[model samples]
Target: MAIQRRGFIAAVGTGGAVGLAGCTGLGDDTGDSDNTGPEISGETLTLTTTTSTYDTGLLDELNAPFEDRYGVTVVTVAQGTGAALETARNGDSDVVMVHARSLEDEFMEDGFGVNRRDLMFNDFVIVGNSDDPAGVGGEEDIEAALTAIADAESEFVSRGDNSGTHTKELELWDAAGLTIEEFGEWYIDGGGGMGEILNQASMQEAYTLADRGTYLDMQDEIDLEIHVEGPVKDGPDELMNTYGIVAVNPAVHEHVNYDLAMAYIGYITSVEGQDIIESYTSAGEQLFFAEALSEDPEFQQYVPEGWGSSTDDE
Candidate 1:
């Protein structure tokens, strides 16, 4: 059974708010004659999303207008990307908003998700002590920066909870040809979320990977500085972090609320939702860049990144 919450905010309108799959120029009102879109049956939407969205407070802003327009309560569960997907796999969530594309691909491939759409994007940064103990400041290449950190044996904090940031950190280490198992006391497994990991790094004066939004939101409270920038600051493409929304496949879980899930997905990818995300800021700095309204979205927007070619080969 889905956990229910009543946070609905009634809006002043009698039109449809759901957006199309392609999501072009759609908002609260699409100027239709009847203005009555598909009937949504549910009153509560369970959204399992990553901690960065919740930590940066973007989720509340994004969900407010959505809840108001639909008159439905949005119960959000903020966890790691891995955990969020796992929750959906157990039929506990109606939709999932997350990063870490590789894990998302696995989930969709396993028939647990559908209608995956490119929602928004941000980048990950490598932060450490301001003194630059590893001497990796301003490094454009993430892999090279990781290699430098490893070579210096710098005390690095890892988000060992397998969050999106942790996934990116592991990928960077692998790209640099380094293994986590070989590391000694220099590596600290921070089995926590982004905010907790950032706080841990600050207390220990160690290095860690963090999303730009969370880092900026807590920048004043933490002593660490960004040693390597992400794509948001003209950094390498490897650091680019793209987020997507996937509706749990109703075929697998008959109890899932597919209509409400599609409505939520449509609204977020629509113009209004994109505007809300692009305008959101932490410490007066833009936290995310909207990607759904792009002129030419990749094939991966609706499916896995390489699903086409993989199917051709098979």
Candidate 2:
């Protein structure tokens, strides 16, 4: 299915402060409304964030403890970064947690958002079968690895769903001077979310790029090994994969819960929030690394003095 940009905006209007009592299915109703319960007079907030964080089970760890401490409930709508950003732009969501730095900057520059803050980060990796048919294993350079994959005509599954992850992958391929047209047959655009793309890659025994967090979370279900990592895995100047949070500008859309949204952003960037992100792990492996907001020079260029730390590890 094509990513639903409009549905994301509409979904934000449906949020409430109630904690989901069960494993609410991805598309299930969230039980939120204007007068369904107590007015959002307290600290409860709604967040529209990326599917990568949600799929990897990081948000739950961050939100559960936060709700108890702040007497607030965080209702999250997990979608592509573009969708999440659109939701914020439309004032359907209070805050947005997303990875596409360039897009996030545009959102802020366009006045759809404010108080854009840097949060935690993780890297993306190229995974493949143990046999390494594409011979990309252990390659320290991403461009070279991708070139080898294209030259070898190995199966490469792509999440063509226009997600932040997908956007990053396309950027890397473009940077390699290898257009999608040049590697047509070998590339399989899964056109889905991260988890589904990983599943397809495992089934095909193909090479695919994935965020470290999602791959670690679903590692048990796949046989692929991390063939490329570190700078090659999205931490060089070009591959830096940063995640940020922004509160939608109340001026753009009146329905946004501005105070609650800012609170969510503030809490996520706070020492306690960073601590929660640092402590999140899957299968004994750390999913994300916290970058001190106070220490980053690039963060200073985009954010105010006390917004929060931004992570560009990926």
Candidate 3:
């Protein structure tokens, strides 16, 4: 049953309609024929998503199973979360997978997407040189950690590209209540992807914020150690990293394949999808922890339910 379901999902395709009336069976006059018309063919779905997931190679793993099951070709355009959201808003993609919740909410509220389902999650971690010059290691308080770094004039690399990681970094600084604007040279902005930023931080021996998945994937090449994690990584606001897959509203964009887009969304949020997410790991470490689609309290509160109240996950 699972294999058959997977096959059904992989064959789904999407395309723009000449008119909904002619394609959606609303205008069909055949009384003897089923309302469902011929299967959609040769349709392509464009997905605009975050670079972190792409850089970490998570999307490829997640999408491969779906593609094999659905027989549909998915074209992924990877960019920063901000750019991804903007692309979805501009109707350039049929679906969006991003991590910026507030921005995503605004997009949905504006009617660009029909629904946003909570996907998998991986927390951010503060990585720095092994020397630990800032003495931020094992620190659970993010604000104090940053303050120490600022006071020590420790080198800090930032993903200034408006990516989700960058957004989280800025929020951390804000929570620390330190004006990073005054600490000029100590801060470095790598206007590139997470991989590039990691390389830059390594080259400079600077501290930087990174998703756990990317850090784990590149751990061998990096001399940095996980300094701050959990709430301190993004502050006490749960600091949970939540990803959402949203279907571009067909009502707003005539070219979007609403049926196939929704189908993909449905598959991704289903139990099978969560199982796939849970199965991916790097060096024996889970890449992303699965989040149930149920209205669990922890999910509702931005923390994965049963994730424990501690700052670090076991």
Model 1 regions lying over 4 Å from their true place: 1-42
Please give the distance, in angstroms, between residue 309's alpha carbon in candidate 3 and its true position after superposition: 26
On TM-score, the leading prediction is 1
lDDT for each candidate structure: 0.84, 0.73, 0.73
**TM-score of every candidate relative to the true structure:** 0.88, 0.79, 0.80
lDDT of 3 by residue, 1-314 (tens): 01111111221132212222122432233454666653434467788988777877777877776666556778999998888988888889998998877677677768888656677677787889999999999886778888999999999998898778888788878887887678878898788888888989998999998888888888988887888776423443335566777788889998887766766676676556666677777888777766534443234322223335465554
Identify the runs in model 3 with alpha carbons over 4 angstroms from their true place. Answer: 1-38, 231-238, 295-314
Q: Ranking under TM-score, best-scoring first?
A: 1, 3, 2
TM-score of 3: 0.80
Worst 10 residues of 1 by lDDT: 1-10
Flag the better candidate by lDDT, 2 or 3. 2
Instruction: Please write out the lDDT profile of model 1 over residues 49-116, one tens digit for every residue.
Output: 99999999999999988777766789999999999999999999999999999999999999999999
For model 2, name the residue pairs that clash.
15-32, 16-32, 118-309, 118-310, 241-314, 293-309
Model 1 TM-score on a 0 to 1 scale: 0.88
Model 3 clashing residue pairs (backbone): 9-70, 10-69, 10-70, 10-71, 11-70, 11-71
